[model samples]
Target chain A: MATTIIETGGLTRSYGDICALKPLDLQVPEGEWLSVMGHSGSGKSTLMNLVGGLDRPSAGSLMVGGEDLLALSEDGLARFRREFVGIIFQQHHLVPYLTAVENVMLAQYFHSVPDEAEARSALERVGLGHRLKNRPGELSGGEQQRVCIARAIINSPKLLLGDEPTGNLDHKSTVMIMELLKELRAEERFTVVMVTHNQEVAAWGDRTIYLDDGVLVREERTNS
Target chain B: MLFRILKNSFLKRPKAVLLIFLSITMGAAVATAFLGISGEISHKMALELRSYGANILLEPSAVEGGFLREEDLPKIKTVFWKYNITGFTPYLFSIAEFSAGGKKERGVVSGTWFAKQLEVPGEDSSIQGIKGIAPWWEVQGRWPEDAAEAIIGAALAKRLNVVAGGDVTTIVRGRSQQFRIVGVVTTGGYEEEQLFAPLVTVQSLLQLPGKVSRVLVSALTVPMDDFGKKDPATMSKDEYEKWYCTAYVTSVAKNVEEVMAGSRAKPIWQIASAEGALLKKLNSVMLLLTVLALGASATAVSTSLMASMAERSPEIALMKAVGADRFQISAIFVGETLLISMAGGVVGYLLGDQLAEVISRTVFSSTIVSPLWLFPTAIISALSVAIAGSVVPLRRALLIEPVRVLKG
Candidate 1:
């Protein structure tokens, strides 16, 4: 078995009188695809946010790649974010002003000194080599999603996070995105955690965890 | 890389950056202009005071029942602090009427004690003498040394229609004397209306020997402060002694009064106060302009960054989601700002120098040359603007919760 890349024990988060997450414990082995599924208002997104260092948990012992996430300062977590994690959003958050290649290069720029050749190759891997100079608004929805995927993988992060990456996609684009994600994961061997409401989307992962009302209700594993 | 980001950002958003740059340049230019003008005022005031010819003056002292003898002048040169005494010129004046071509001009016939009549040894006889009497006095001809020779002020000569080498009849105290005018002196004031002749000639013509109403002694002295300006009669004993000892204007005036006979002396204090007040106001105005400029620049910067940050929220959110630490996130933004500010400072400094020169010339009719220090000052000021203006928007960028952003 590969190393346990993500572990959370007794994680909790609250919003005034409401609890967003409640005493959650989970472990994610390296290079595994774990999908979190639930209806709206479930804690899946909050758990994904905590694991991504986007939001701090109210109470938890959380570790990513063996570093204690709760002990790290805000800036320390930013370093971990920039160098160790890649996230793909459902809206495909490519800077509208930048070309597809430039958007991909921005990741490398923030993570390290930018390398154009590396960015180009990453775009090529995501089937975006032909559209490198197209701006986000100029591209199709599928192409924009592909550009986002290229940007995410450009920095070669240890974990790849997807939050409803196919939610806004057509069926063909969804299949293409899912296939591309699987291929990239197999090639790069990065831990994957995706949050989705679509059961078809959740089925692409190695395991599925169902959450409701900020509690884990079910966990299931499937072999390909 | 940070610079590249800043450059590109500025290129993408020229109007905003230019606004900040202009405001900063305005601040620096005003500071340079006002400081430069203040310095010029102080210099001009000093030159005007120097027109008094000497910082010290001496004269006859009739102390109730005592009279200081003319022999006391030698003692002036031998005072305990005599080395501080540079040089002195003594004058003797007698009222006389001068007639040239039947134009009678009544003016004081003043004579100076020089080595050779009005001529001094070693210095050009042509350049020294009554020309030296008021060194600040500009003269057009040589000083007269021969019998019946005189140097007349330009204003007096103008009134008498006299010139150098021209014969003028001088009548002094019921005595008629004919003298040759050899020089014209211009002292910028009343001195320009006086007739200047040899001391011996004036003495013999007036029949008054061994008497000079006053002596002017020029000496370097420090500017007077509040303590130095206080009246000795109202001062404490220690304050009085200290005021009487320092080489201040009041102290030097007292020293000259003590050494001379039958005269009182005063400092050119009005000139000093005028210069000081102008400088104080000018410096304060410069400071106020600097603050206003920096403030305007900071606002310009904040507005630009705020606009750009709105456009870059998704990018910031993406970075946060990818696990970038706050330091890493801020480094990219702050480093880019610093780079742009430094570039702006360099350009602003150069622009500000030319701006200062133009402002001084147009507003004050004087040339202004910016000193070398303003370059760093501009750069530091721009950097401060970047830092100050960034706090709000950077906080906004950091607050973009990637989880919520990604939920879309």
Candidate 2:
């Protein structure tokens, strides 16, 4: 009887002559973790971008948290992205000039007003208290990704989107990032839509949807 | 938060920020220097032209047996446009036989004030003479100082075979007077064909006391426009009043004529018209140069900012991807540019002041004091160039697609 937080009916996206995502009908209940699995060029990232409001669907309806994204302006979509969705890119795209704490505050700055103490606390939660003043160049790959996570979760979003959040990390660092996400999600009670190619990483989600050549192929449920 | 980001960005990317800053600074410096010196250049040029000759000529109304009163010369300093009358000198010419060094010749003998100081009621004492009005006259020796001393013209001295330290006897209708030749003057004009002596001595020798043939007046006047060229006799009451009040050469001449009885004052058009035309052209050239320099500097700033924007695309994309709206993105970039421009404005103003001084000293052999408003003008111009330069790059930055950029 859980309420559905995301509902997409025949959602589609195309770039010029090529369709990145076919008509996709999907729904995710509140607080559920949904994983999208696909091979290279299989439109997994396209779905994540559309759901995160970073890209628009060419056709069909997309409703997230009772808001019709198709009807919103570009600025409205930006507001929705800041208030409703937080995205963690696989590249760990942090502003190299800003420190770890300042990077987290950047998110709060866009959301409302920057709170330095809260940004510090968010970094501390991500286990980067000692590296608060260190810029992205001074941090390791895993540590930078942790700063990305801290920045993502600082605004308290309702839906968190991860595009292979651990694609560049080794097995140990990947496991640590997943464990941290699991703990944060348990406490925050936010929905997660993670896109990945690794079967082991997909196993961390409550359910997995596989895509092949821009079409949905199969589904799997995890008993975690 | 904006300030923090701007600080860190500038600290981290000194090369790009400095490039844009330098462009704005150069533009602002050129603008400030040109604008600062433009007004001074015209004034200096006018003063230089004034040395060519006097612009106003005063003479008796009648051509025959006509004379201007010598006592009326002091009233020239108390006219409505008195301050505009920089200097004036009176001349009394009489044909006489000049004899010096055992040689004799017939030439014109001219009496004029040679740097005599005049004090009028309710007016400060002022030096008014040929020395002030005709500065181009080159003298081989000193000017005459006493009733017995005279400065003979080069031609007249050559005709009489006389030099400085010689004595000359001038005979007018058999009334002869002796004068010590103190100086020999070369004027390249009719003055070189006449002998110059103190006015009082000439008046006494000619038995024509307190009488002058002509007066040359020099005045500072604005360039004549159509309104200034209008005849006061044909104008309405208000228009005539306006024309009379303006410091045009014609108006200033009229002011002098009204003061001197039975005298006609007219502008020496050869000098006044030439000065007006030259001043007008010089001002136009300065204005054109200022606009061209500003345009060139704007191009430099735009090119530099565009290049920096290209290099910073990834950072802008990252900001956009992190939920920075258009206003936020604009704020960051605009804030950075404004901070750089303000610093550039201050630096450019200082540099431009020095530049104006150098130009003034080199061209006019004088110094210039920039007006107080030039400071704010320079800063505003810098800001304008910065904003103008940021337009295209800011638009490009806003058009950046985060998905494409971050995917790289």
Candidate 3:
């Protein structure tokens, strides 16, 4: 009986002559972990970007948490992204000059006011307490990804999007990251939409959707 | 948060920040140096112009052998524009036969004040004479200080075969006077063919007491524009009044003429016009240089910022992806630039002050004190350049899309 937090009717995106995403109708319930699987250039990342308010749709309605994103201005979308959504990138795009704790505080700064203690606590929760002062260049790939996770969750977003969050990590680090995301989701009760190419990563989601050539081809549910 | 970001950004990109900072500093320094010295140059040039000779010439209105009243000479210091009259000296001329060192020569005897101090009623006593107006005069020995002493011009002295510490006797009509030659003056003019003696002594010999042939007045005046060049006779009452009130050379000459009765006053256009034209050109050149320097600095800053923006696009995209609105992004960039500009302003002010001093010493052979307002002027100019340079880069940064930038 969970209410739908994300509802898209005929949502579409295009770049000049190239159509990145076609008209599609879909709904995601509150607190559901949705995984998207596709080959390169299949528009899985485009859907994530649209849902996170990072990209605008070419046509159709996109409603997330009762707000029609198509009606909002550019700054309004930015506000929505800061208050309602958190995103984890594949490259772990932390400001290279700032330390791990400072990176987490950067999110807090853009959302509202930055609190150093809260940023430190977030980093400690991600098992990077001892490396709070280390810059991204000095940190390992797993530690840097952990800092990225700390920055993502610092603002307490209602929805989280990940575009191959662990694509550069080894198998052990990927397993650790997936487990950490699952535990955080259980406690925080936020919706997650993650895009991945590996089936093992897709298996961690509650439901998996497959995309081919910008079209939704199939869907599968995991009885978790 | 803004301060933290600015601090970190500057610390992280030293080379880029330094480049922009240097551009702003150079622009501000050039502006400050030019502005600081421009005002002083006009005044200095005016003083140098004054050394060429008096700008106002006062002569008798009568064409046939009339003389200006020597008694009225002190009234030249009591005119409406009294303070503007820097100095004035009266001259009385007579043909006399002079004999010195056993040689006799026919020459002109000129009577004038070398450094005569005058006391006008209800006014401060002032030294008014050739020493003040003709600062470029080169005398071999000394100015005549006694009624019986005289200074012979170089040409006249050569003809008379006289040197300093010699005696000259003047025979005028039937009267005779003896003068001790105290100095030999070389003016490279008609004055070099004359013998200069104390006014009272020459007056006594000529038997024309308290009569002067002419007066030369040196006064400070503003540059003459088209309006100032208009004739007072053609102007309306109000326009004439405004022209009279202004400190143009013509107006100052008219002020002196009003005080000296039966005398005609005219601006020596050779000096006055030349001074005005030179001052105007110098000011125009300074203005042009200031504009060019500021424009060049702004371009340098823009180029530097454009390069840095390209290098930092990914960071800006990441900030936008983390939910930084345009306002927040602008705040960070603007805050960083303003901080750099302020620092540049302070440093540039110091550098420009030195530059102004060096220029003043080199060009004018004098020193100058920079005005207090120049500090704030430098800072404001620096800020203006920074803001102007950052406009394009900031627009580019705002137009960035996180989806395309963060895509791997």
Candidate 4:
């Protein structure tokens, strides 16, 4: 029996009168790759944000790593996010002024003391070793996404959240980024929660759940 | 990491940093210049007030040509309040016809000590002369050293066509004495029309032995207050004793009067009181302007920083998302501002020093030496401006919601 890393009981988030995520119960065991598939405005990103501690849910309980996230203050949530969950955005948000190495070091800095050697090795693991000094603008779409991956995992977070991490990439770059994430997960043994609309991307995960109109409609287990 | 981030950010936005730097620099510069000059002005004014020709004028108490005995001069140094007196010079005046190179002018021939050394029993010997009391008088040549030597006034020198090396014949009544003009003095007052010579030489020339018509005394004195203004004749014994002990101009004049026989001493109230009032007003004005200037620059720094913070919201948000706490974020921004302010302060101090020199030269017709304490003052004030300007902006930076900012 595996321990549940993330457990949500009737976790719901709403903006004004429009409910983004209805009261839904969800669970992910440790080291499981959980994929969320949804159309636009289908509450996939909302679930990812809440689980990553980026935003607060309108109602219900959210527990990550056996700690109640709902009870944590804003600063506490920030610490939770940095220590437990790493987020990769579709836009690959890197501080534009900082180089790839510095971006990686930023996560390590917030977690504890920044170790340049660790940050450099993390970038090397993401296949960005040669481009450590290059800023985000100097890298290609795939390279920039790789830099984001490097920064996200620099602190060795226990959970990784990717909201369309490869949405802006070409098929070749998308496959490369997916393979890289798969390799990193295999080595790090961290649970992954990814939100995507693509069936092929969802197929990379061990399990997939479909959300529609702020409700979970279907679920499937992928053969990995 | 914080310093690295701030360094990169500042480098990336040179224009914004420069804007803040310029405002802080200007504020610090103005503060330094105003404060430096104000301090120097007050010091100079005190000296000028003390040197205002003479604060006390002594004349023979008897009517007409009655003179005080010259032997009583040393008694001025042995008075009850003698230490307060800086210098005193005696003068004896007589009308004479001055003729040189066929040019003639009738002028008052004033006899005065040039740099006479006097010794009083039980006191250190001191130099008491016109050189100490009348520092404003511009003399082109040396003082007279012999009975045949004299210093002609600028006006008399011009009228008689006499130069410093030339000889002037002084005719008193039916008697005539030829004297070498050792110096031509320009006093910019009635002294410019009179001739000046050694007191002993003039006494012999006029045949009045050991007599001084008047004396001018310069003394360091406190500004007069209500008690100091009270009439000495009406004060009680204790009040009079207290008044006499204080080094007010009135009290010093009274002290000199007591020591000099058959002489009346009067304080030159016009110069003393006017100098005090003018210095007080000028210092207040400088302080007011310094405050206004600092306030204005602080506002400028605030405005510029606020604008920059708005432009850098996304950067700030990203930092927060990366798990930077409020203290970490504030440290980055405040540390940057403090560093910039320190740089501005040093630059401002150098600039303000030159500015003060220029201002003093142009306005006061003199130069000023900047005091050493002003450097720290400039830096501290610059730090204050930076901190004051960044308070609202840092609070705003802390309140920035990373979720909303990172959404776009």
Candidate 5:
């Protein structure tokens, strides 16, 4: 009996007169890898932002882990994002001044007391044990992305969100990152909601949904 | 972790941190310098005012060579306002030819008390002398104690080639006395041309026993008001008593005049009024300059921090996206500014202490004691500038929308 980790009913977000995400109903079960495929200007990023508690919806209800995110204040949403969700950005946004280990510790610090040992082991788990002291600028594109992945999971969040996480990587790096994500998800048993435009990346998920013109146009189940 | 982030950020952006540090240091330094100097200046001015503090000058009222009797001097301490008069010294001036080492100079020889102790019956004995009144007169040696001992003024010593421990001959009305010069006094006034001797010596030399030409009195006096300026002779009996009782310089002079026979007492208005007016103006100017300097530094701090905040928006946004609440974000930025300000304050205090010394030496031609209170003043002011300057920047940091900032 799989429980629904994220449930949205008619969740809508709009900027002025332009609606970025129309009223759409969606449900993501626990431990499921859900991929959202959309072209540019499509509401993929907007949906991800709302689910990550970084954006407020124009209308509708969003419940993540049985807590109504719509009812949470900005500070409450921040706590929710830190305690319940982990996000990986397309640009691999790590504090440029902080080293890889420090960046991983940053997440742990916000969630609770920072544990350097836990942060170190998280980086090591992501194959960045030797590069703990290297800053983002000193690392390669793939290495920077790996550091971001370590930071995102340092708190062991129940839900992971990736907004085109591998969009800037080469094919080998992209494949390697996806495999790492798959292994981490299997071990951690956390639900993943990824937004991408690539079919190959969508195939790595258990399910895929296509959004066009602020509307969900299709849903497809891939390999279990 | 937050400290680590802030440390790294500060190290990475040395220009911005240094800009803030410099502004805070400059503000604290100016504040400390102005405040230190103002306090020291007031203290020095008070001492200078005290040195030239002869508020009451008593002279013989008669046009003839009549003098105030020495017997009447003890009556000054028994007057109705006796305690108000801090000290008084009598002077008998005579023109005499001073000859020493074959050099001759005609100079005014003044006979005055030199730390003489006097007793009034049924009252506490007190010291009444030039030492109590003219503290600014720099003496190179010692005051005259013997009847045949004298202190020659600096200019008079130069004219007569007299030094301390030398013998000088003084001839007055063809009656001459040989005296040992014990000290050379530098008064920076007309007194620098006179020779000072004990009152008994001058009395015997001038053949005027138990007589004094004038007296200079130092008293603790309040600033004169309209009531204090009224003529005591013209006032009613009640008004006159009121005028006589007050410690105003004019009233104190009147009290002295009433106790001394045939003496006309007047207040030295130039020094009394100048002290008040100058101190008020100087304090106001210092306060205004301190406020302006603090405001200018706060603005500089704000401008520099704002520029840095704009540059670090992405870092701020990333922190927010990673779950940093408003308090956490504010703590990082405010903590950094506070640490910089604390360092600035200590450095500013040291620099400002030296600056105050330079200013006092150059302007007042004197050294000042740096008050211990100014250290905390410097630090608190630095803290004020940091806190004031960071308000806007912290607000901007908190208002940063992570979605918009991290979109790229």
Candidate 6:
């Protein structure tokens, strides 16, 4: 009975007349690894978008670590995103122009004054020490995702959201990224919400939730 | 950090930055050269007019009363502006005939202090009294060194078939004096149809020693308005001389009258004032050219920055999404423009100076010296163009929807 880190009640989202996410209720305890599994358009990515402050819920109360996210202004939300939450996308959205170290430094720039030395160490922690000066186009897919992971956690956010963090990786690279994430979570103790379609990936988390047609159909707990 | 960012960004896109830089440079160069040469020309023209003898002239109070005496010169030099007094050359004109190269022509025989012989204290030939007064006079030969020698004007010399080392005779009051022609002067005025000799020699030969009809005085005077040229009869005596001697045209005339006995004086201002009006118009045209040039520069900058902004939307969205406010984003873009402008301004100023020299030399066949203040003026103009042109594009950059763009 750990304290709950995220609480959502009656959360719903709509685009025009079509509902993208229906009302739902969920609670996740602190320091948990939760995996969301579903097909494309299953509302899993939409739910992640709402939780990550990228989109607003049409009707809901979202309390993340005791803060009411719905009441924050745009800039306030940006500050919250910088200081409290970090997100990784499937596309690896790292700026192509900056090197791996500089990409990590950008997260610090948003949170505070960028510290190059700290960013360098962050890249090294992600096993990108040898590719600090390599641009995204120059790095392999796995290395680019590693740099994105480095950027996400450079600010030491309390929450990490991954939308297919290794969707484009090879089988070995996928295992490498998951192991890296599991190790980082063990040390940092930040809660993670990962969206994936692979059951093997879902097994790594403490609990797995399944969604279909924007509705939660089932929930499974794997860890004792 | 902003400068570093500016430098890095500029280096990243040299082609785009160079386009804006070159355009701003052209704008600054045009502004600096036109305004610089315009100001200098106005000042130089003013100086040239100042040396055109008295702005106000004086003769005997009554035409037949009498002439001024040589003793009056000391009093003229001792006026309130005794120090501001430049120099005075006296003249006594007599209608006479002269012969040169076996040809005789009727010419005005003028008595000048030295006519053409120029020498100062340290020099061998005298530099006074007429040679110093008429500096713009182009001379073909030397001025007369002896009392019996004279210089003929180019027009009169051609009419009389005369050259240097020739002789001419002048008849006045039933007495004729033979004098050698020493020099021919061209003043581009009525002075070109006259003969010049030593004042003492002319006075004695005419049997009117120590007498001068009038005097031409060159003084440094301030510019005057139309009201400053009001008729003297309409002014009170206190108002008269005050208006006459304050280094202005009216002041010069009043000062000359105060010193010379039974004589009146006038300034050369009427001619200068007319020239001033024309010059003021020319300067306005130059100013119009500068404004139009800057406007064109701004337009060019705007076009190029807009093109760059199109290519940089993704970067702008990236920065915006990363929590950069509008001001910070603008700093990066405008800072880039300003840095390029600084380099452009320095290059443009040097280019424009040479351009002005070439244009002036080719058109007017006269050398134009570009002044120093043009450099900073060029830089400021370039900076302003860069700032002005980037404003709208920067606003466009700020308006980019970070979420929409990044999501795309």
Best by DockQ: 3
Model 2 regions lying over 4 Å from their true place: A1-4, B60-66, B79-84, B93-110, B120-126, B138-198, B201-208, B225-247, B254-258, B262-264
lDDT of each: 0.74, 0.90, 0.91, 0.89, 0.90, 0.78
Stretches of candidate 6 exceeding 4 Å from the true structure: A1-78, A191-224, B1-11, B27-39, B43-267, B285-295, B349-375
- Worst 10-residue lDDT window, candidate 5 chain A: A109-118
lDDT of 5 by residue, B1-408 (tens): 877977898899999999999999999999999999997777666556666757788999976366989889999898877876778899998899989999898999898899999989999999999999988889999998899999989999998888999999999999998999999999889999999999999999999999999999877665566887787778999998787777777887878888888999988888767665666677888999999999999999999999999999998898899898999889899999999999989988888888999999998998888889999999999999999999999999999999999984
**Residue pairs in clash, model 2:** none
lDDT of 1 at B291: 73
Worst 10 residues of 6 chain A by lDDT: A73-82
Write down the worst ten-residue block by lDDT for model 5 chain B: B44-53
- Model 4 Cα shift for residue B295 (angstroms): 2.3
Error of 6 at A222 (Å): 7.5
Candidate 3 C-alpha lDDT tens digits along A124-193? 8889989998999999998998899889999998999999999999999999999999989998899999
lDDT of residue B164 for candidate 6: 84
Question: lDDT per residue, candidate 2, A1-224, as tens digits?
Answer: 99999999999999999999999999999999999999988989999988888889999999999899999887788889889988898989998899999999999999999999999999999999999999999999999999999999999989999999999999999999999999999989999999999999999999999999889999989976
Q: Per-residue lDDT of B81-140 in model 4, one digit per residue for the tens?
A: 777778899999999998889888899888889898897889999998988988888889
Give lDDT: candidate 6, residue A89.
71
CAPRI band for model 2: medium
True contacts reproduced, candidate 2: 0.62
User: What value of lDDT does candidate 2 attain over all alpha carbons?
Assistant: 0.90
Cα deviation of A105 in candidate 6 (Å)?
A: 2.1
Best candidate, lDDT-wise?
3
What does candidate 4's lDDT look like per residue over A1-224, in tens digits? 99999999999999999999999999999999999999999999889889988889999999999889999987888788878888888888888888999988888888899888988999999898899999999999999999999988887889999989999999999999999999999999999999999999999999999999889999999996
Q: Encode model 5's per-residue lDDT on A43-127: one tens digit a residue.
A: 9999999999999999999999998999998899899999999999999998888899999999998889999999899999999
The DockQ of each candidate is 0.40, 0.60, 0.67, 0.39, 0.59, 0.21
Candidate 1 C-alpha lDDT tens digits along B72-186: 4554554434444445666778678889998988888876655432233333232222334356667678767687787788888999888887888889878978888887877
Cα TM-score per model: 0.70, 0.87, 0.84, 0.72, 0.73, 0.69
